[model samples]
Target: MADLSVNFAGISSPNPFWLASGPLTNTGYQVMKAFDMGWGGAVWKTVGEPVINVSSRLAAIDYGGRRMMGLNNIELISDRPIDDNLREIAEVKRRFPHHAVIVSLMLASDPTLWSDMMRRVEDTGADGVELNFGCPHGMSERGMGSVVGQVPEYSQQITAYAKSGSSLPVIVKLTPNVTDVRMPARAAVAGGADALSLINTINSVMGLDVETWLPDPHVADRGSHGGYCGPAVKPIGLYMVSALANDRRVPVPLCGIGGIETWRDAVEYLLLGAGAVQVCTAAMHYGFRIIDDLTEGLNDYLDRKGLASVQDLVGKAKHRVGDWNDLRLSYSYKTVAEIHADQCIGCNLCFVACDDGGHQCIDRLPGQRAPVVRKDDCVGCNLCSLVCPVPGCIEMQDIDLGLVETWRQRQSRVGF
Candidate 1:
C-alpha cells in the first residue's frame, strides 16, 4: 500500500486526516478516543477566556431528507479553564506521543497576551499552535476571531507576536467571511506563520422558525448570525485552497478545512494543494469510526494509481486552475453532450432540465423515450449530464477542430 503519512510544516502524522478544532476536541477524553479510532492528529478546540454558552446552540439545514447538509452554530471557543485545557493537552501528548496534538487559540489583540498564551501552549508539549483568527460568530463581535483575520495588518502583527513567544510552528487559521480570502492569507504569511489552515466557518443565520418567527437556534426569542459549515462549504474551501496554492507570495503549507466528509473529498483538497485535511461535521454526524474508512479508501486509491506516497498527489491539479482569459477560445474546440441509449433510463429529467435551465439543445421524438441532442446548438454546459439520474447516461464528447487560440492570443493578434 502507498504511504499515507504526511509531514505538514514540521509536524508529522501517521496519516493526512486530522480532527478539526470544534466541539469534538473540547476534552481529553474525546481526543484520546479519536486517536484510538485511527485519526492521525487532533487540533484541540480553541482555548482562551471562558464564556457561558446558550442552551440552544446548534442548528442544521436539511435538504432532500438529508439531515445537517449544512451546520450552523453560535458556539464559542473552549469554555473550559485554560489550566484544565493545558493539563489535558500535556497528558494527551504523553499518552499518544506519535500523534500530532495542536492547540487552537483565540484571544484579544494584545501582543503580550498572545505571546504569553503561546508560551503556555508550548509548555504543554503540543506539536504546534493554530492562531484561531477565523471564528465568525461570538468571538468576532469582541474584536477577535474573524476581526483579526479580516484585516491583513492585524493578522501579520498577531502572527508575529505568536512567533516571538514560542519556538513551535504557528498555523494561522483564516476566516472565510472576507471579500478576498487571499488578502488575509498573504497577511498571515507576512506575519511569519509556518503554515495556514482555512476556511473557518462562514457567517450565516441557519433559518427562522416560521411559527415562532424567531431565528433558528434562538436564545429565547432572539437569534443571531452564527458560523456556517459542513458539506455546503466544500466548493468555497476548494477555491480558497487553490487560490493560495497558485499564489507565489504565500508559499507555506496549507491545511484544508470545510465540508470534508469522505476520503474522496479529502483527495480533492489534497489534489488542490492541502498538505493535510481537517474534519468536523462528518465526524460529529457519523462517529469517529469513520476514520477507518477514510484511511483505507485513501490508501486503496493511492495504490491503484501507482503512487508510493500521499504527498505525490499534493498540488497535482493546481495548474489546471486559472483565470477565464487563459481558457481556450478556439471556435473549433467544442464539446457536445451525447446520450447513451443503453444506459439511458428513459427519464426525461435531463431533457426537461436542459430545455428549461440550460440551452434548448435537446428534443424528444414523437414516440421515443430517449431525447436527442442538437449538436449544433449544444453548448456543453453539462447541465443535462448533471441532471441525469443514471451515471454515464449523458457524456460530453470533446471535438477538436485541429485549432487552438486563447483570448490573450486573440488580443495580441488584433493588435488593439
Candidate 2:
C-alpha cells in the first residue's frame, strides 16, 4: 500500500487533502468534523478584525445540470471575534495533534499588527500559519487581501513580518489576479516563506439577473464583483500552478487550490508540483463526507501507479510544461482525427462542429451514416472529438513527419 502521508513545509498531515479557507472551514466544529471524515488538514477561515458579511453572499453558475460549475462570492473574512477563533484553534490543535492545523490570517498593513497576530496564532499550537493575501472581494477594498497579494513588494514585506513574529511555518496564499503569478510567488519565497498555496479565487462578476435587472446574489438591487472559483476554474488553476512549479526562482512547496473536486483533480495538482491540495467549492457542494472518497481514491490510484507515497507523485509532470515557443512546429509533427465508424452514432455533431466552427475536414458521404475525416485537411484541433457525445469515437492519431523543429529552432535557422 502506498503511504498517503505527507510532510509539507514542516507541517505533517496524514494525507494531502486539506480544506481551503472558506465558509466550510469557518468553525472548530466544521474543521473537526472534516478531520473525522478523513481530511488530512484544514486552513481555518481567515481571522482578522471581525466584519459583518452581507446576506445573499453567494452566486453560482450551473452548466449541463451541474450545479455550481463555478461559484462566486462577495463574502469577507471571518466575522467571529478574534478571541473566539484563537481559542478554538488552540483547542482543535490540542485535540487533533497529528493533523495539520494551519490558521489563515489577514490584518491591517501595520507591521506591528502582523507581528502580533503571528505570535497569537502560534500560541494556538497550530502546525503553521497561512497569510491570507488571496481573498479577492470585500477584503481587497479594505486595503488587505489581494491588495497585498497583487503587489510583489507588499507580499514580501508582509510575509517577512509574519515570519519574524513566529516560529511556525508561514505559507503565503497567492491570488491569481495578476498578469503573472510568478512575481508574487518569488516575492513570498524571498520573504522566508516555507511554502506557497495558489491560486486564490479569481476576480469576477458571476452574472446578471435579467428578470430583476440586478447582478447575481444581489444585496437588494445591488451586487458587487466577487471571487470566482469551482470546477470551471480548474484549467486556470493548473496553468498557474505549473507555471510556478516550472520556475527555478520560486523554490518552495506548493499547496494547489481552485477547482479540485476529486482524487483525479488532486493527482493533477501533485504531478504539477504541488505538495498538497486545498478544496473549497467541492467540499461546500458535496459536504465533508467527500473526504472518504478523496482518500480512498487517491490511495487506490497511488497503488495502481506503483508509487510508494504521495510525495513521489509531486512534480513528476513538471518537465512536460514549457513555453509555447518550445512546442514543435506543425511541419515537424502532426495528428489527424480518426473517427471510429462502427462506434459513431451518426449524430453528425462532429461534422457540424468541424464545418462551422473548426477546420472543414469532416465530410458526410451521401450513402454513409458516419462522417469521413479528410485527414489531409484535418488540423488536429480536437474540436470533432470534443463535440462527439460518444467517448473514443474520434481519436487523434500522431503522424511522425520525420522532422523535428521548434519555433525557436526555426527562428534561429532563418536568422530572424
Candidate 3:
C-alpha cells in the first residue's frame, strides 16, 4: 500500500489531511473527535483572551444545490479560556503524540503578547504553532488578525517574534486579500517561519434578507463582513499556494487550505506542493465524518495512480503551471454553447453574454437581436456557450489557424 504519510517542517503526519483552525476545531472535544476520524492533524482554533461570540455568528450560501458551497462567519478566536485550551492541548498531546497538534493563536498587536503566548503554547508540548494571521472579521477588527497579516512587515515581525519565543516549529497562516501572495510568504520565510498555511477566509457578506433587504444571519438591524470560506474559495487558495510554491526562494512547507471538501481537492493541493491540506468550512458543513471521504478518496486515488505515497504526488503539477505569456498560443478552442430552446424560454442570457462578453457572435430573432453567435466573429472563447443555461445555445466553431491565414497575418504581418 502506498503510504500517505507526509513529512512537513520535520513533523510527520499519518496523512496529508488536516483540520484547519476555525470554529470546527474550537474545543478539545472537537479536536479529539477529528483525530479519531482520520484527519492527520489539526490546527486548533485561534485562541486568545476568552471572548463571547455573537448569537448569529455564521451564515452560508449554497452553489449548484451543494449545501454550504460558501460560508461566512463573524466569530472571533476561541471562546474557551486560555488556561483551559492549554490544559487540553497538554492532554491531547499526551494522548496523540504522533498526530500534529498545531495551536493557532490570535493576540494583541504587541510583540510582548505574541512572545508570551508563543511560550505558553509551546509549554503544551504541541508539535507546532500556527499564527492566525487571516481572519477577516471580528478579531481582524480588533487589529489582531488580517489587519496584521495584510502588512508584510508586521507579518514578518510577528512571525519572527513567535519563532524566537517558541521551541516548537511555527507556521504562519496567511491572508489572501493581498494583491500578490508571494510577498507575505517570502516575508514569513525571512522571519524564520518553519512553514506557511493559507488562505484564511476572505472578507464577505453572507446574504440579504429578501424582505428587509439586509444581510442574513442578520444581527440587530446590521451585519458585519465575515470571513468567507468554503468550496468556492478552494481554487483561489490553490492558486496562491501554487504561486508561492513555484517561487524558488520560498519552499516553506505549505499547509494548503480554502475549499478542501473531498479527497480530490486535497490531492490537487498536495500535487501543487502543499506539504499538508486543511479544511474548516467543509468540516463545519459536513461534520468531522467528512474525513472519511478525505482519507479514503485520497487513498483510492493514490492506489489507482499506482503511487505508493503522498510525497510522490506533491508538486507533480507545479512545473506544469507557467506564466500567461508562455501559454500555448497555438492551442485554439472555439465557443461551444448548447441551446436548449425548450428550456431557454428565450432568456437572452446567451445573447447578452455573446454580445457583451466578447464578439457579437450570438444572433437573436430576426427583429430582436436574440444573440445568435456569428461564427466568423466568434473566437470560440466559450463565454457565450457557458452562459446558455438552456444547454447548447451558442456553440463556438473550432478554428484551426492552419486552415486560415488570419492569425498569422494578425501577428506576423503588420499594415505597411
By TM-score, the best candidate is: 2
True lDDT of residue 354, candidate 2: 96
lDDT of 1 by residue, 65-127 (tens): 999999999999998999999999999999999999999998888889988898899889999
lDDT scores of the candidates, listed in order: 0.93, 0.93, 0.82
Candidate 1: pairs in clash: none
Q: How high is each candidate's TM-score?
A: 0.97, 0.98, 0.86
Candidate 3 lDDT (Cα, whole model)? 0.82
Tens-digit lDDT track for model 3 on 1-416? 67988888988889888888877777788888888888889999888888888877888887787788888888888888899999998888888889989899877767788788888887898989999888887777787789888888988898888888867888999999899988888988899999999999898877788988888676788888888889888899999989998998797888899998888888889888888999888788778898888788888898999999998998899877767644434334233444545445677776777677666766776754344444555565767667666555454454455433335443665541
Better of 1 and 3 by lDDT: 1
Candidate 1: where are CA atoms >4 Å away? none
Clashes per model (N, Cα, C within 3 A): 0, 0, 27
Q: Give candidate 2's whole-model lDDT.
A: 0.93
TM-score of 1: 0.97
Error of 2 at 74 (Å): 0.9
What local lDDT does model 2 show for residue 117?
90
Flag regions of model 3 displaced more than 4 Å. Answer: 330-358, 362-377, 388-416
Worst 10 residues of 2 by lDDT: 204-213
